[model samples]
Target: MLRLTVHRHFSTSSAFFANRAIVYHSNGNPRSVLSALTFPSLRSPPPNSLNIKYLLAPVNPADINVIEGVYPSKPSPTKLNSDNVFVAGNEGLAEVTGVGSGVSGFENGQWVVTGKQQCGTWRSGANVNVEDVIKVPKGASEVGAATITVNPATAYNMLSEFVDLKEGDWVIQNGANSAVGQAVIQIAASRGLKTINFIRNRENVDALKKQLEELGATHVTTYEELSQKSFRDKVKEWTGGKPLRLALNCVSGPETMSMARLLGSDAHLVSYGAMSKQPLSLPTSLFIFKNLKSVGYWQSRWYTERTKEEREKLMEVLVGLMREGKLKEPEHEIVTLGAGESDEEASNKVRDVMKNIMEGQYGKKVLLRLEGE
Candidate 1:
């Protein structure tokens, strides 16, 4: 478990409050453009708003893509007092410090997550509308709640929505060591389905396989093993000749096509991420003869399109799994931000983390822990 040190102070006078945030003035490399800005004083929130003190925020690949100006959706630039800049980060967990007169369904000390992406989550605190955040189950760990909205949701939706999967059915996915991939393995296992996971051969390949198997993965292999014709016979032996009805592909290129070949007739191949930056190529015969269907999934778009009730129900199911110990939190490293740090110091620390993220230095997920209760 991750421990947080809290520093709490409050004043009746509005001018005595302070806040800090990681922001960018222009779209470019995160290391070059990102900076820290501090608000010397904050006024009380207006009616229908709540003062939120951020607890933990995660640095996701999509967040980096947004910083590089290549993502499909762009964050709107806004004034933080006088500077027109974009605040960094999208997903995080926060606590309600104060609520306005018109706000309901929330109170001081309750935890909530940003209801949508690009809400500028990497901050010490902010005043936001009640509808912009969703209350999370207090029983869930900070790391689990902080990282819930993106990867886990993606994995859950892909497993439940793409195909009518049932118990004893087998599903295959590449990039099986990724956060979403791991979630898929556990979630599928909980549903009584089997997973055939493929990952890149790493230095600690055996340890990695053991770790995933402990998480309920039916079978784990490497991309090299997946490419061999003989490996298909091994897959057959493992599944007892059961048809692989659904395939998840995050790493595109030839590796994805190879995985797709394992799917049975009329099966679905869902593409969510292209980490390899390679185009997907399918053999004409496989599409024509097997009637394989290629589809794409984007969780952000799904959140925007789905109804509020539907979203809440999905979250309820996920939270239930967490409470039941059916879902496990992924490995993570915490980056702490002290309350007394200067603007330059905060910027430097955040930039260092960003540089590491760009270089893939963090073997586990990176989450921010801001000071204050």
Candidate 2:
């Protein structure tokens, strides 16, 4: 379907090497964080692994972080040949091309998605343990392929993780405008839980609040309004004394303190991101007198270490909602890959988009699409 060359080793400061790629390539070095390119191998594995041909892969901030050396979750290299090292992408919807001699659950041409508890997420194909891939639902949309790893799972888990929030209870969160935040609002509402979402006032605060409320948010307030004591009082009255039990956060610093105070005694406050990138300042009294908790939620850690059967169940529920069109993927920029695309061409396109984020004008995730889907 497509052809290009690429390198898989990271012996230098640059994240990965690029020879050429079926995806794209830039001349010499790349300006985008992804290596000049990454390529799939043609080498044969010892009879026990399945060869996958990936259809779609998500380009997340964490994926960018991995390329930048900021993310701790890095894939170890595997020997494919004397010259080529194996690079794997963790989350992508793929199809099986070659089944191993002993593989049981899959056959050639079966559509699958990698759920291997490791990262192999950027390439076009993979050779993995047959037990590692999960069958994707039939007729799964191509556009929905690359977008389901961390945020959606985080939104699903955090709500049900530490507490069993009853129908009338409330869960508040900062960064309520993010994709995860939107998912949290939707899922919580489906369970009849109320949400008090907080966000930085950008364009159309009123409109944003209305949109979130339509998704079942109880209230959508901004960072500035968070400081007033009356706002907390209003939240208290709004909950009608049913108790605010959870706070899912990304922005910390001052907002954390304010949101923390809004919770009932022994309420759980889970911080998922450092949007402010500032350290959380906690008052000892919140822990001692109010019995409030400050917990950090890293979705990858949970995905790797927590309950699998349960997690898969949640994913099944999520995918069903998506199929029904009640839940939709975020709006994102798509980088096309096809019959004869170059790594540099893809890199240059991504560089422009990253420049947009640095300039504070970009929103939504970016997905890389492969040919022959």
- Per-prediction CA RMSD (Å): 5.9, 5.7
Predicted candidate 2 versus true structure: per-residue lDDT over 128-226, tens digit per residue: 776566665553465564566567778988998888878778888999988889989888887888888998888888998998898878889988888
Which residues of candidate 2, in runs, are more than 4 Å off?
Answer: 1-33, 36-46, 78-90, 357-361
- Residue 116 in candidate 1, Cα distance off native in Å: 1.7
- Point to the candidate with the largest TM-score: 1
TM-scores, all candidates, are 0.92, 0.84
Number of clashes in every candidate structure? 0, 19
User: Measured by TM-score, how close is model 2 to the native structure?
Assistant: 0.84
Worst 10 residues of 2 by lDDT: 21-30
Query: How far in Å is the alpha carbon of 50 misplaced in model 2?
Result: 2.1
